[model samples]
Target: MDARWLILADDLTGAADCAIAFRRRGRAAAVIWGETAWDEEVPVLSYDADSRGLAEAAAAQRHAALLQRFHTAGRRLFKKIDSTLRGHPAAEIAATLAPLRAVHGHAFGILAPAFPGTGRTTVDGRVRVGGRPLEDTEVWRRDHRYETAELGAMLATAGLASRVLPLETVRGAGLAGALAEAASVPDRIAVCDAETDDDLSRIAEAGLAMDAAPFFIGSAGLAHALAASAPPQGLDPVRIGPDGRGALFVVGSMADISRAGARRLVAEGAVLHLPVTPHTLLADADGRAGLAAQVAERLAAGGDVLVEIVLAGEPDMSLGLRLAHALADALASVAGEIGALAATGGETAAALLTRLEIRGIHLADEIEPGVSLGLTLGRFSIPIATKAGAFGDADSLVRIRDRLRKARTEGSLT
Candidate 1:
């Protein structure tokens, strides 16, 4: 029987980004969060647990519950964690393994969270972004829950035993045997080092060669390798309607990468750029309506629009959530005029979808490495694309806009 895959992520962008790995390989994949119907024969289902910001205990509990509901003996499980190790990876990994271990008599986790395409690599079980240790990077300094950048240490703090599989061993011919030996130890996780896509492919092959199913943990890099190793399933593309209305782009992240991409879009002059502050969104109803009307008018005239949240002075972390919600509300007011949607951050995408009453999205194709284009399946059915806050380069947003425009014109987006 063909192996069914389950990708459980902490947020919407992570879920869609990973699911597109399977979709690109011609396997049927869909991303859903909250209550939604599922097709048993879809082959791959990526569910967003939406627990990135939750407390450690709460995140673990949420993942455990979702695993209990969706996990089965035959399904190949991939726990999607942030490439930079931002979320509760240690806790979520343990929560995922508990029920599996109970049923299989033993379970081992094979984690490789390196997405080399995006400059994230694991060397000697330590995560590095661009050539710097993850802890020393801006991402970790801004929002990190772990005490260190070492994978083994993080796992140990979560009460889990782990061993690092160095790069030499991973790249050697004895990889499969080494992984088998590692899996022999009950509840022991083997954190493999990978520096490139080929390294990830080797790890995927070795991990899949095991007799019993081992829980796989990684980012889209590993997912792509695993999906490639699976049996061929012909692509099932969805038809995207012609773009007669304007597309909407929402930027809700304060990350430097996201800001750079938005700036590039503005410089390109391909879309109408509108910047709003949290105070304006929260206190100015007339201002919100007026802004929405302007966006709607632009969209109705077949022009693309980009709306970004800009802070006035010093950063106010407390206003992030409120500003996100306000942006979502403003977008919802003009949902009818929107022909397509592209959101940069996970939280921003989730809020926009919820406010628009969209239940789920059927992932169609990937516009770029981390950018996923799909069709909305619920209340607001339109072509949409999503990318993580910190995944792409300055020109990533411009590429997305061009791809969507090309897909719409060619009438073969799916």
Candidate 2:
């Protein structure tokens, strides 16, 4: 009988790792997980198919990487792979791994991560395989809708009914608390929100170090902001209520300010509201519509005065592009004797001056994520910042806020 293989696939790297495990013994291969009905599952294989999209809840570069990693040699490889697991669930996967498995001779298995609410069936609990419990391995995984489908394919091929199981419980401290179930190896953890590239460098950093990490699902506001879809709840950013508006700055997103705790910063008079452009709102289409409108309305209502306490909304691309013209027209065209407009939001903070055609300004408030302060008293020009959404990242929001505070206290705006 073939030995049981519990493949762990989280993101693209997770998938790659699964294939790598069997590379020395079984045929390990990669397959592009194309899109399909959200709740559908198929337990069969046909080599001729598109790659599956590893929906991160995944990022753009990560997907692009998957496309780059899975390089098929030829139809012959597929033909040979198809012969072994002719009627298997993950036969397609088996076929793809045939070449590697042929050399290694170990049964092929897939490892995947469990996504929230996506039906997952796991037969292997936190038990040992030959005195080696699953929990103590170098990696642990879960499955989303797509990986679950692949697993179903595997079970069907092995002539076993689908088994659903939960991953081992993790408990500890800080992020380590999240990894309690796994063996301690100083694993790298990354909050992946594929819509943006903010955390890519870090995620890549974590991924490249393979053996020391098991991906964990953390609630990062930035991840949701950068995701292609607006996450169901808090991931979505909204303009703060009028009562909470402060000196609007630039380079911020809903994720930065959506939290009840983060909102507390505003409620306590730490952050303010700054003017935004229509260009930013339009970039996200409906996503930034309401907030952009609010920013526009505030600026129109004579709020463009020399204020020093507001923050900018998300680094709305459309807003960043157009706000300069709007600000130029407002300042140069309308508000003669214009001095400087305060701002926040990372991308907007950085692009405002160039976009608005202004030369410079000064920084007034100093605040940040960790509460450390920064002051700027000299070269205060158009206060611009690198925003989270500008590069499609969510966690950048926290950094944006922290940077804002630090920038404010560190130097005078220019």
Candidate 3:
């Protein structure tokens, strides 16, 4: 099948989650980042721009360059943003519109950044999480770059014109006409309000039916809507079962959800937990080698292991990146023995996979709303699950372990 969709994300977890949406629908989607090149034959391709932590201008430049390189005829575009609006979304959206307008006589974008399964919803052009406004959430307080969570105000800050489609209009019968009319205005973006998967599906259908192909901008929720509406590719989806060896889980995120999940799994005596400080990870060669040997020995004995970075408190942005790379380096040697891999945090996943020489992941299933199960595309083909740090519950890691075990025993990706 020809390439039909191109998804560009600012980080690794976002890329995997969105691509897996299509994979679940048998679209043969694959996610690639870092040095991995594009594959034209893949029906759906998700590319991580790795600009989540960059300044606004740098992030915009990175996305603009990626679009010029990857955007092509007959391939629809999807811009994946953080559900909580943590990254350089406004700049990136403006960058996307400029290039698309230059290429296609007119360019229009429908922004619906809601993933209901993960408790993120857009109401009145503002984001709400778990019945609370985004500004009240811990994530926004800790990591948000923008001063406001108001969608139109955020876009306006970047000098982009935007109109909010209230829930009333989105659910109305004339959504398609409304979207088309909004698109006729140059550089205007439609910020849609949606609270559920069904609401997102309605927005997607309306956008798809327009006379011109609209550029989609949202989270995995929007990706799922588009994937469900996609035509059959007639290509056999890749089915991967697990190997008998033990699984290796890496928790490098500072999110409470991730830490709670790891703690629950360890407290249950399901796996051996090895918690190391950032100092230990960045320690001398012998120290790092010893950690690798211990991990490898556990996996070689068919025992699961959990390797986590224990920070005293939240490190600054630079330290977080350094810590992830250090953790990746410590685990590089045992990467080959990993029968199954699960990682939390996009930067952590990207660093570890790149060190392991994995080119991409052929997605298979979504273990949860923000978690994706897939197999490595290059070098090693082990079963892998990728999850964003803030998503899932205290039992998320336990569920991941159980799911990996079941997949190995059943010899299917269910």
Candidate 4:
């Protein structure tokens, strides 16, 4: 309930841990690790940043040690990614971020650890990934889990305890529905784990929607996804697609599971933008919203539209609300009691239900940290399966997509 300053960073866990470590005595703050900037819409814990190591160092070499881990993270996440990832982490000059250096190159997994406390120590200056020197290009390309480790270390040093929650447990359960018992806040933000730079852009969209509620999106994976269905953005060369649709999330990534899964989501209507606010996703659409307007027009024309939303990105809850509003508006004219709505994608189902206020829900599984997908079927009287940005393999999407398609055709409400 204090004046908490939410810091949008490459990793929310690091941000949270940093807040704990860098506390200035009177401030009450915390971090909500996310999959991407867009997934911030769902506060459900199914989605979690791989905050394995992030603790402020008690030793003088703490910051330097962080740089070493950063190198490995770069390799894990960005190293194996194609040249054009939509939500890749922000470009970090190796020389500026780490210590050992060669020809300076870019790193996708940079921690946005806020300089908390009364005094200030900035990380923006170019540093190197320490430990035996190497050229800039030699720095690890994409390592997401390394970022988690950094967060864990920082949290430990900051004297904060972290608990992992399984988001899958709350599937089909709306935020206000079963979780009403959880420590409630006026607003909660979810972000894509991010594997690209533009993945962080959802912060702008989320900021507009949440207003003063306080939230943002960003992460080591370098991308963000709107939990409500929407397309992937920031695709290279293509900018906006031939359909005039813009490419979404252009981050570097080495995670085969996230890469393949999110790509498919971006192609289907599952990834379309959903906004949130008291008024819904369009909390800020002033008729000038190009993408929303375009999607709306297509829907109004009675066109069979399917939007693909990236669950891996972990967008902000505020943005998810906006995205939900869009999808709901698309279905606004539906006169049916709804034969059976099939919800898929990480936070998509949950964001939609929560935004729609579908009530009566219960978690079927225990919450697991870093695991996406929650399942619940009650209250709302409909089956809801939500993803939280953790997919083990590329085939994961194919399986889920198959299940969703089958459910749609077979009327499998369970």
lDDT of 2 by residue, 1-414 (tens): 111222212222122222222221222222113331111121111111212222222322332333234322221111111101111213333332333333333222212222111111122321221233323321122112222223344335434333222232111122233222222322211212221132322332333233432222211111111121211222111111121121244333223232323333344444434334354333444534444455555545434222212224433333333453344333233222222233332223333433344332111221221111111112332233322221222333344444443333443321
Query: Which model, 2 or 3, shows the larger TM-score?
Result: 3
- Candidates sorted by TM-score, descending order? 1, 3, 4, 2
Model 4 spans with C-alpha error above 4 angstroms = 1-152, 157-259, 262-305, 309-349, 360-380, 390-392, 408-414
TM value for model 2 = 0.25
- What lDDT would candidate 4 get against the real structure? 0.28
Per-candidate Cα lDDT values, in order, are 0.88, 0.27, 0.87, 0.28
> What tens digits encode model 1's per-residue C-alpha lDDT throughout 270-372?
7999998787799999889888998999999999999999986656765766787888887787888988889998889988898899988898899888899
Tens digit of per-residue lDDT, candidate 3, span 132-251: 999999888778888889999989988999889999999998788789878878889999999999999999889888878889999999989888886644546445654777899999
lDDT, candidate 4, 5-122, per-residue tens: 2233223222322232112222222233222222222222112222112221222243233334332212112111111111222222111233323112321122221111111111
Please give the range of 10 consecutive residues that has the lowest summed lDDT in model 3: 233-242
Deviation from truth (RMSD, Å), model 2: 18.6
Candidate 3 displacement at residue 358 in angstroms: 0.8
- Per candidate, the number of residue pairs that clash is 0, 110, 0, 154
Off by over 4 Å in 3: 1-3, 231-237, 240-242
Q: What's the TM-score of every candidate structure?
A: 0.96, 0.25, 0.95, 0.30
Give candidate 1 misplaced runs (Cα > 4 Å): none
- Specify the poorest-scoring 10-residue window by lDDT in model 1: 312-321
